[model samples]
Target: MALSIRQKRVRRISGDPVDGVVVQGPVDGLATGTPLYSVAVQGTIDGRTTCRPRGWRFGTWNVGTLTGRSLEVVEELQRRMVDVAALQEVRWKGEGTRFVGAKGGRYKLWWKGDDGTGGVGVMVREELLEQ
Candidate 1:
């Protein structure tokens, strides 16, 4: 005997109209247990409505310690154009935000840890700080 499996179909629901925009229907070919939907944004740029997609690079790493190698880590991340990163095992005591890297390429490090042995941190490119 052969086993048969059935996949659940995701139903598309119409969202309430906002700013004269009505979002309806689901994207095709992305059927899964959870429903996935996309939104179309119409923004005015100098009296023009434009729709564009923005992208960013992300990374994750378990740095042994950030005591003396913080700058090095920032340099590597910049070289790879990583917009945001989730770091583990930072090994830095206390929680605070600090600037790292050289003049041209800089990143803000937000870290939190009780002791100096285990911690987590997030590094974001300086250019995207305001956003």
Candidate 2:
């Protein structure tokens, strides 16, 4: 089936600092790969109106359980000028250097959860972050 185009506008009512909500619609006419969604969130945390810009790009993968490799995926992810990465289904032994090495040591990671059960991981680029 062909993908559909969707556009949605969301207005914030309350002052919530943390949120994980998806914007209503797709920005471009295509929705098959990397549907780009832009978000502009403005609110007052402490009587100060702050505007935060965020972009969420969505991709679909059919990697089966215990199939496909994390290293290869990381390589592909590196191609993008991504400031940060949220990785999942990653497994590494010993120090995380091995994985960092896989990313060409271009990133420093903070492993929030290391249960070895494929959870969320954050990778940040030093150069982009310093800017």
Candidate 3:
């Protein structure tokens, strides 16, 4: 299934309709380097909105050997509210299957490794796909 996000513009105080301008774009970061397009629609200045110190967190970590720590690592990810993660030196040989987490969470794991030494993969929270 393919999912996308489209936002609608808010109304002005004077009850006037604002002009909406949409910008589309794509980014390539996969091993195949396939492009994924996204659209952003321009809207009125929602002056009422404000910024907060809290924000989304994403990063990469070296799991060393994720053999017996799959659940542990995933649970830690939940604790940190990690939206995206890139794993390195997983120490797992061969390409592993999708990572399943609590509450029906999931991830895709790909590795080109040698003898459980060095492996790399990007772990995307399944919810990220909805965006």
Candidate 4:
């Protein structure tokens, strides 16, 4: 699936004031309190396919489970400008940096689950990979 990202001006945002990473702007296509990768993934706000501005978004969430659908989550990552996302209960097997999504770019998932029950992982953005 191709990510519908409108590459506009880079909206730099810092995950937090203390972290000092530049992050700005909100996801245009997403609604308030909606699961980013839910059945409703796209919509027009004003006759334009909403796009993500460049920035660093950071957060943590309990995914409950993770698999192929993780690709959908990757879109959410870019859509939200999340530079790093710490996910719990991923329910994945083993551990490694598994590349995902259409960008051909990738995210690193270091996971450990007990028979697909409980797992943890952190996804880092491509631009900020070296760190």
Give the distance in Å from residue 58's predicted Cα in candidate 3 to where it truly belongs. Answer: 1.2
Could you give candidate 1's per-residue lDDT for residues 46-85 as a string of tens digits?
6666654344556677777888988888877776666787
User: Who is ahead in lDDT, 2 or 4?
Assistant: 4
lDDT of candidate 2? 0.46
* lDDT for position 65 in model 1: 83
Question: Could you tell me which residue pairs clash in candidate 3?
Answer: none
Q: Pick the candidate with the highest lDDT.
A: 1
Estimate the TM-score of every prediction.
0.62, 0.43, 0.52, 0.54
C-alpha RMSD for every candidate: 9.7, 6.9, 12.1, 12.6
Q: Which ten residues in a row have the lowest lDDT in candidate 3?
A: 25-34
Candidate 4: Cα lDDT at 98: 69
How well does candidate 2 match the true structure in TM-score terms?
A: 0.43
Q: Write the per-residue lDDT of candidate 3 for residues 1-131, one digit (tens) a residue.
A: 44442333232344433334333323222222223333343344464333232233455677777777777767766665665667777787777557557656665455557788888866777776666
Task: Give the residue spans of candidate 2 off by over 4 A.
Answer: 1-5, 15-36, 42-74, 93-105, 112-119
Question: How does each model score on lDDT?
Answer: 0.66, 0.46, 0.56, 0.58
User: What's the lDDT for candidate 4?
Assistant: 0.58
Judging by TM-score, tell me the better candidate of 2 and 4.
4
